[model samples]
Target: MATGPAKDEKCCLVAVTLDKDTIGQGPPDVEHERRVAIYDLLEKNRFVLRDYADEGPYNLRLQIIDRKLVLAVDRQDGVPLITHILSLTPLRRIVRDYFLICESYYAAIRTAMPSQIEAIDVGRRGLHDEGSHLLIERLKGKIEVDFETARRLFTLISVLLWKGQGR
Candidate 1:
């Protein structure tokens, strides 16, 4: 499988795999969040590989190995392309904070006033943005993804982290 995309070629993620052995079984809400993130990512995303032939609709497999996040990219026909191993250490704090904020947001939605819910949502989105930016920075030179794509990927990563923690 080619590693680079062609000139001006646009690529998108078509599939995702999360290793159940490492991540374990998540709760219903976590599973739902994972599904939604993947669906949204597939629905709309711009992913490009540097110095490689541009071909689209890549399949990605996510796994945690030795406390690192492994992103494996493959072709439509299941041919392997490239694998990016990112340190999970940088993501730990943000993921933890994001989950805490999400929990508060959900709780606020259940009983807090509209303003309260909105406030909490704002925090959650901010944390999400931070995490997305970190993801982009971490993936720099390995792969390129737009803000929305990184956001969705960040969501998935958060889910993986949560599941990895057995929470």
Candidate 2:
């Protein structure tokens, strides 16, 4: 499998890997085009994705403030892709490890379903204080960013991911 890093400034992790057995694949450009297609879509939608260069079959977890956005694709069908939102209610430390397992599963499934090309937000639930609740509500209907304030919010929320992880 070929793994490479993404060049986006805001992304901290981005990678594309294929089954090792599938050597001399269809065309190198297939992966490239697929990557570009996904990246372009996220960029067009204003969602910032991090890029990381590592081995195959890893989970993509994006921490936005007090929320851990975890993406998981099915192992065979690649359909019914799941995105888990772990509310950093108190934030924990075990998130990184759990996130890895999540990625591994996604990577394995990605091999079987080459035709799967859809993403669905399974569900979202969280714990929050009054202020956080207000902010979360505001962030619900639509996505908006206030740069300076959002930067702080993201930092705070990201920290919350590890708060209750028995660290």
Best by lDDT: 1
Worst 10 residues of 2 by lDDT: 117-126
Clashes of each: 7, 25
Which regions of candidate 2 are displaced past 4 Å? 1-38, 46-87, 90-101, 104-138, 141-167
- Cα lDDT tens digits for candidate 1, 27-101: 777778888887777777777766544655577888888899999887756788888898999989999999889
TM-score of each model, paired residue for residue: 0.88, 0.20
lDDT of 2: 0.33
lDDT of 2 at 28: 35
Residue runs of model 1 more than 4 Å from their true location after superposition: 1-10
Colliding residue pairs in candidate 1: 4-52, 4-53, 5-52, 5-53, 5-54, 6-53, 6-54
Residue lDDT tens for model 2, 46-138: 222122112212323333333433333222212233444545433333334433333344554466443331221111112212334444444
